[model samples]
Target: GSWHPETGGLHEAFGDITAILTMISQMDQCEAIICHSKGDLHAKTYFSAVAEEFGYALYGRTQGLRNADNDLTMSQVTEEVHDISQVFTGAFYDILADIFEDYCCPEKYDAAETLFRIGKHITSLLLQALLKGPSSNATFSDIAKLMISLEPKKKWKDMIRRQFSVRGVVGKGAKKVKAPVDLVWGGCHCS
Candidate 1:
């Protein structure tokens, strides 16, 4: 559901708006429709129609929910923005690597691939966090620390361990830590 204003033409935006409306039309039991970016006239119109048709409460500025536009409730926006930043950082790294390889060693794409993978993984983690809304009782930072620890790089493992230590937590849980390697392995250890 990533929309780039530069890449998405007017027709594509219209199609997305139409598709959203079509999905809303099929919902049997919709309580509250929370539409972000209701500042867009097209989205506002589509959401208004959805609210009316489904008799669902609309909670967006388009319908007059001004107080809900505060920065606290829209944490997903910040997370998504971070995801986009990570994506761009990876893309920039790839582009630079491509240019370097064209003039230097042609087999250095692996480095770029690794960079891209890290960026993609970070973005995916943030997306999962967004899907599992923060109020559902899991912080994205904690999930990120866990995922980073699972990487093949020792740096990520040490980073997570250091973060856990700084937070004054004994182990992955609140109990005493038995072994650092055990917590870092997360059931994948052998031999």
Candidate 2:
């Protein structure tokens, strides 16, 4: 399920955290498979097959684990899970604050909903990048281009393009200027 802050109380929040951890574990497994196989088509095909067969099995195990925690009572949550949840929440809040600062029309959006959509979009971009190639050295620009290409909305595409533009400080004769260092896209760099 998508991230919705208004959904429930602490119990639901714990469940969502548990689910996110499970998904991360699954992605780690897939990444290992890809790396071990040197990112061949056979590896991708095998992952597809494995995902279809064991996806529900993993989900069941996650649910059972959650259920065993007795609805994620604070006292029942393991120390590790508790720590992870804290870190995740802190990071979410930090990112949300950054987005709010950067957003042009914050008044037009709900903070929680915007954060949720950002989370979903980032997840989608990550998975799409993995599917494109299991390159260990994939850069931010690579993912940004993928996002720009996959995003259907022109406004979002423009926003992404602007976001990815290079910015740096230039100095000459004791003068300093903050400026767009370059606008790099599709292997072309412009300043």
Give the top-scoring candidate (TM-score): 2
lDDT scores for all predictions?
0.31, 0.36
Worst 10 residues of 1 by lDDT: 66-75
**Model 2 ranges with Cα > 4 A deviation:** 1-109, 134-136, 167-191
lDDT (Cα, tens digit) per residue for candidate 2, span 1-191: 12211112223333543344343245455355335535331222332222233445666432232221111222222334333233222222232233423442547754333434454654564457446732433323344456567766676555554443321001121112122233345664768
What is candidate 2's TM-score against the reference?
0.30
TM-score of each: 0.23, 0.30
- Report the C-alpha lDDT of model 1 over 1-191, residue by residue, as the tens digit: 22322122222222332333343333221112222322221233333232242233444334322111111211122233322222222222222223223333326533333333343543443345335433322332334344444545465445434433333232444222122121233575679
Distance from true location, Cα of 96 in model 1, Å:
17
Name the best candidate (by lDDT): 2
